[model samples]
Each structure stands twice: as C-alpha cells, then as structure tokens.
Target: MIVLKNPHLSVHIDEMQGAELRGIYTPDARNALASYEWSSPTPVGRGASYGSSEMDWLSGYRGGWQETIPNAGQNCVVDGVELGFHGDASRTRWSIVDQGADWCTLETSTRLPIRVRRTMRLDPDRAVMYIEGHVVNESDLEIVFLWGHHPAFPSVDGGRIDLPDGCTIHPDVNRSGDLLTQDSPWPMAKTSSGEFADLSEQPALGSHRLLYVTGNKVGWSAVRQPDPYVSVAMSWDVAKHPYVWLWTMRQTPEYPWYGRASMFALEAQSAWPYDGLAGAKQRGQGIKIKPRGEESSWMTLAIIPNGSGTVTGVTKNGEVTFKSSEMH
Candidate 1:
C-alpha cells in the first residue's frame, strides 16, 4: 500500500495491482471517516494471483462476491434480464494507466459484453478530484446499464447539507409506502424554525447521510459541520445527472452500517427516483448512441480546505462552465 499524505489530506494507493484509492482525507478527518464501517476497501480488493477466493468473487457464478456499487442497492433486473447494480465497472479491478503529483488514471473492462475506462484524478492544490467514465459497446446488441458516482462523506453532529438553490426535494416512498418528512431544509431553512410542511422530517444526523435530487443543468451540495472546522463540497454536471441520493442510516438497529459514521454523499446519477436502466425503460429516458460511437460524462468534487471551493465541468471541445458553488 502506497500512502500519500500532506498537510491538507492523506490518501492510500495500491501499486503493482491496479492503483486504487484505499483511503482519502486529512488526519483530522480520521474520526469522521473511521466512525463508519466500510464493507470493503475503497478500491476493489483483488489478489495478486488468480485463485478460488479471487475467482469466486470476480466470476459471475459465485454468490459471495459483494457487488461494488455504492449507496445501498442491488443489481437491476427487468424482464428476466439482469443489469448488475451500479454496473460491473466499479466491482472489477482497475489498472493504473498514468499518474502525477495531483492526478492519476485507472482503467478496467467488463466480463459479459461492455468495455469501460474510468479515470480518477485528484489535485490537492485545487482541492478537487475529477472522475471520467468512458464506455464502449463491444457487442452488437445494445447494452443497458446504470452509471453513477457515489462518494460517502464523513458525518458530524449538528451537520447539515447546503444546496445551491432552495429547490424542493422529495424522497421515494419507504417500504411501507410512507413518505419521510422533515422539519426544514437545512442550511436553507431552520428545523425548529418552521412547521412540518411538504418536506420530509429532518433525518436525525447520524453515521448515515442523505440524498437529494436536482434538475438537469448544474448544482452543488455541501456537508457543513457545526464547529466550522471541516466541510466537504461536491459538484457535478446536471446535464447528465439531475438526481442525487442522500442516504443516512444511523438509528436502525437491524444493520451494522447504522450510525457507524455519517457521510453526505453527493451522487451524480443519470436518472431520478429509480435506477438508470429501470428509470429509462419506465420513463423513456434512455440515452441513445450510434453504432461504434461513444458517450461521455464528467463530474468534479472539490473538498474545500476551509469552508470554500469551486466545481466546474467541460465539454469534449473544451467549452467549460461552472456547475455549482459555496466558494466564499
């Protein structure tokens, strides 16, 4: 394990194997990070040599392999066809294609029918991490999948989320088909300051985070601490993904992940209220590409050192624009 540390942040990367980020954040950020129990390492854990343990998880036949998709969900299946959760890209091992003081690239491919190249770059000076997902359809038939970025942020007491605009947020009906209510939209409105209206109840701040959905365009979300000592800002292109999932599971006694630590994940998702593939088929929002052609999407996450930073996105032609902010 290669550990990279600086005054502002610390990261662990594994070489030899596909270079992946094992740990991220500064020393002071440890308490929040360690509070939560991680199902697996940041990078997919793979062995140096191919063996039963390795093949059991990586291979499609074995049931022991935990799917690498984040934000608590399983594979998407429709009409007896299975679309692996969050796709198979994250679960597969990635190779270090390139690197630098502030940036690195990792590449991986799919087993069944698709080939994908995902690149992640981090710049401490700018306090930003850039992720690019590139997918190519190798088979003749069209392959349907869900593409999303799930970054779990550390949770703190009295921590609240900040959004760019006072946009309305709605949650999916729970298993019992009940809506979760909130007293107020934090950082925008006060919890005790107002009566319970249409918004869901303020999730008791815990190790579990929250999810919010935005419209297509640009938007930003921030997790603010009460002490003002630390804050994490996430921004992404709203054009490709308008919905964000805010997950918080601290109080639940049935699961071990409950309250281990809190993280406000700013997810960049291609669909809203449902998985990409399912949402597409249900709402006819599927993206179409020409044969042998390609589609690309990018998201930028900036962890402001002191309650400030910027997030932006650019096109293939280099046309760049701001996505969202809390940068004062």
Candidate 2:
C-alpha cells in the first residue's frame, strides 16, 4: 500500500494492480475512517477470482474471459455472457499513469478488449475527491457491460440519501425488493414535504449502506453522519449518466476489512431501471461508440463537514442539486 499525504488529508492506496483506494483519512477532523471487508485475490472454482462469489467473475465455460478473448488471462464474463459487474475492469491490474500532490491517474486494459483510464483528484480546499472514467472499446466487435462506481463508506446512523426533482425511489425488485410481497411500483410518489417515502425503515449503520435507483435526468445523492466530522457528497454528469446505485454492507465474521471499518458505497451509474446493456435496449437511453471508439463518464464525491454539504449533478452546464437537509 502507498500513502499519499498533503496538509489537509491523506489517502491510502494499494500499490498492486487495481491501485484501489484503501482508505481516506482527514487528520484535522475527529471522524476517522474505519476498515471493512473486500474480496480476496485468490482464484477459485470455475476460474473465479477473488475469495467471495460476489466479486468473482463467472463464465459459461472454464477459465473465464481469458479463454474467450485473445491475450486475456482472467475471468471477465458471467455464465458465458459478457457483463461488467463486481466492478468494471476489477479483475485486471491497473498501472499508475500520472500522480501529483492532489491528483493521480490509473489505466488498465480489460478482457472485454476494452481499455479504461481513471483519474482521481483530491481537492484539499473543498475536501472533495473527483473520479473520471474514460473508457474505450478497443475491439472491432461491439462491447456491452454494466459500468458503475462502487465507493464504500463507513455505515452509521443518521445517514440518508437525497435525490433530485421528478424522481422516486423504488425497490430493486430483482434483489431485496423480493423480500416484500407487494412488489413496489416504479416511480414512487413523493410526499408534499418533497421527500420520498422510506421504502425500508431499517436504520443506517456503520456497516450497512442503503442502495437506491433514480430515474431523474439530473440530481445528486449524499451519505452524511451525525458526528458532524464525516460526510460525503456524490454528483455526476447527468446528461451522460441518469442512474445511481447505492451499496452498503456490514462487516461480519465471514468478511474482513481490507482497510477502513464498515463502509458505504453510493455509486452513480450510467442508467437507471437496469444495467447499461439492458437500459440501452429497453429504455433507448444508452450511448453508442463506433468500432474502437471511446466514450467517457465522470462522477464527483465531495466531503463536507456538518449539515452544510451539497451534491450537484451537472451536465452541459445545467445542474441538479441535492443538499444534506433533503436526506431522509
């Protein structure tokens, strides 16, 4: 692991392939990050990489993506279908392309025969971190995958998500929503108070991060703790990505923290309702790239103190704002 420090903050990142962010700590603040669980690097049955099934790549044939694509040596498919989950380009190692006091860039090539470059910039003045992902389809064939950000935060009470206007929160239906019998209808109704009803009453925890999907073309989301010392805001280019995914889980005996304690990941995705491919066909909202063409998406996460934080989604100079007070 490599620790990069500045006057206002310090970030820990793995030196290995992914260059993953291990932790982000602010020494001037009282709320420090706690370590949490992640997938192990060990390869397992059917060529699954990582210790847990959730992180492993599953393919219809043996040896995974390595066998399907030329010069590919890792699993990158699920049940023989090409999909980007368990983190896009997560299976491959990333190389540091650039770094400075406040910014760093990493690049990697994937088994989909795609190339992705990520830039992480830390603004000490604003206490925010910006991540921009630029992806290129290097193959002649059309490539389709689900691309989304997964940033885990420390789960804690008093933390809630805020959405933009003309938007509603509904059950995932494919996953947790099955736990409910009614099967929530899409585009839920918002109360007169301008807040959507809480579909799940479970309180926030240091270990669990609530996940939600949004249909709004412009909006932002945030995860705030009552301690007043810790909070994070995420905004995206709404014109490019109209959806968001929130992921949070508690640490258990079965999982160990790779860095900070329990964390929450409030991910901004490219499409709502479904992953990229499904959204493209069903919603007709997907972006298309020419053979070997490139397209990029950007998301920003800002850390602010107390209830004064704000998250805004900006696209083509237009903005959709979400503030701390709007969180339920």
Candidate 3:
C-alpha cells in the first residue's frame, strides 16, 4: 500500500493491483470510499476461462476507485487481443515512477496497445485529491477503447445525489421499482408504482439500478449523506467524459453481492453502455486513438465535513460550495 497524507486528507493506493485507490480519508470519515464484504486487498490468480474476467476483477476489488481503460465492461476479443472485464488497466500492476509527501505518480501498460500514467496529489490544506492522467496508444495502428473512472462510495440511508442543470438519466437496468426504462430529466422520474420517485435520493437496500446520466453540460457530481453530514463531490472535464454511469448496488442479489452489499458508484465515462470495446465500437461509442496518439484528462474529489445536503458546484481544484439557501 502506498500512502500520501496532508493536513486535511489521507490517500491510499495499491501500486501492484491496477494502481487501485484503496480509500480516501478525512477528519470526519475514516474512509469515505465505499467498501465490500467479499473484496480482497491482494491480487488473486486469474481463472482459465475468458468469461472469468468479471470474477477475476472482483476477486481483488477493494472498491475505493479504479481506472478502467482500453475496455470498460465485459470480456471480448478485438483484433485477437482479449480485453478482460473492465479492461487490463485496473487489473494489471503499475510501477511507481515518482513520489513525494502528498503526491505519487504511477505508470502501467496494458495487454492492448495503450499505456497509462497518472498522478495522485493531495491538497496541502483541503480535503481534496486531484488525479491527473493520460492514456496513450503506442501501437502502429488505431485502437478503439473505452475509458472511465470507477469510484464507489459507502451507501448511506437518505443520501442524495446532486448534478448540474441540463443532465438526464438513461436507464439500462432498472430494478429499483422506480425510474422508467427510458430517459428522464435530471432527478425526478415516474415509477410503475403510480408515484414519482426522486432519482436524486439514494434508494434503500435490496434495490439496484444500472443507468447512465447523460447530457452533461458540465462534469460533476456530489453525494451527500444526511446522518454523518458528509458530502463527497467529484469533478472532471465533461468534454473528455460526457456520460456518467450510476451504479447502485443496494444489497443486490447478483453474483458478487449475493444480497450482501450496499454501495453506489458514480462512474464518469468516455463511452456509453456497460459493454466492452467491441460492443462500444459497434454502437459508435468507443474512442479512437491513432498510433502514438495520447489523450489526457483530470478529476478532483472533494470532501465537505458537516456540509449541507446540497452542493452548488465543485471545481477541478477541489473548491466546494454548498447551496446558499441551505447554508447557516
């Protein structure tokens, strides 16, 4: 485990395992990132079957944050290269290129023809962590892929999700008994139960949903927990990541959860659908990179202790401000 600390926040990362972010800490929350009962901290050997990538990815999923690249979901073979579930970027080991008191740089190459490099930096006087990185295609031909950030936070009862204006929700899998299977404006959606449900409010356990929040004029999201009164705000470049994947696993009865998990992951992605690169390309949602081409993006995670239930905005530098009406 590689650790970086400042006066206001602490950051942890596992360099050997996809450079996975283990957790982020502030004075009010021990670890603000979501966790799981079955997730392992150490690497697990891969299974023989190609479809085993999901299990392989989950075997060591500590669930703080992960960098999904070259492929975002599922397993497929493109150009004779097998892309595992969530891709190789988060499953392969990364080398530490540099480190300091409150920052570290890591680099790794994937089974595909791309290379990734990222730097994690903690602010000196704020509860914020800035992640800046880029992915490069080193092969002699163009490559199509999906890239995104998977940051899961612990589920809180009565939690709320905040987004900017002009955003919409596109449901892919709806088990929440709420939300139409079609696109709905930002927060409110009509449910089959003959009532309106606030998509912004986190649902209770035993309900799960896989959806995409698109039409983002700006890239940012804030999850506010009422009881602990903590707000986690994430910000990024919308041009680089136009869609946000909202995954709510509230004690889901799926393979990994088995009715024993409760967490939410707001993934900022460059593509649509949970399908792998092949499927993404088929739908014309995959990103293309020419030989020796590189693309860069940055993200910021900010924590507000004892915050109001709303966040008006979050900047790339981690500056956070809450709703004025809710302020004391």
RMSD of 1: 7.4
Q: Please write out the lDDT profile of model 2 over residues 151-197, one tens digit for every residue.
A: 55555556555555555454444533213312233324243345544
Superposing all C-alpha atoms, what RMSD in Å does each candidate have to the true structure?
7.4, 7.4, 2.3
Candidate 2 Cα deviation (angstroms), residue 253: 7.8
Candidate 2: misplaced stretches above 4 Å?
Answer: 15-17, 29-34, 37-84, 177-211, 250-263, 272-286, 309-328
lDDT of candidate 3 over 190-238, digit per residue (tens)? 6767677787888767777878888998889998876554568999988
- Clashes within 3 Å, all models in order: 21, 18, 0
- lDDT for position 195 in model 3: 74
Candidates in order, TM-scores: namely: 0.67, 0.69, 0.92
Better of 1 and 3 by lDDT: 3
lDDT score of model 1? 0.47
Tens-digit lDDT track of model 1 for 1-328: 5544455566555443333344566556642222232543222244342333223222321111111222113445554655455555545556767766555665666543555565656655654556676667666765554556655544445555555554555454442012343323422322233433222223554323343555435545655554544555666656555666655454443333333433444556665554436556577554444455566667655454443333243333222333355445
Q: What TM-score quantifies how close candidate 2 is to the native fold?
A: 0.69
Candidate order (lDDT): 3, 2, 1
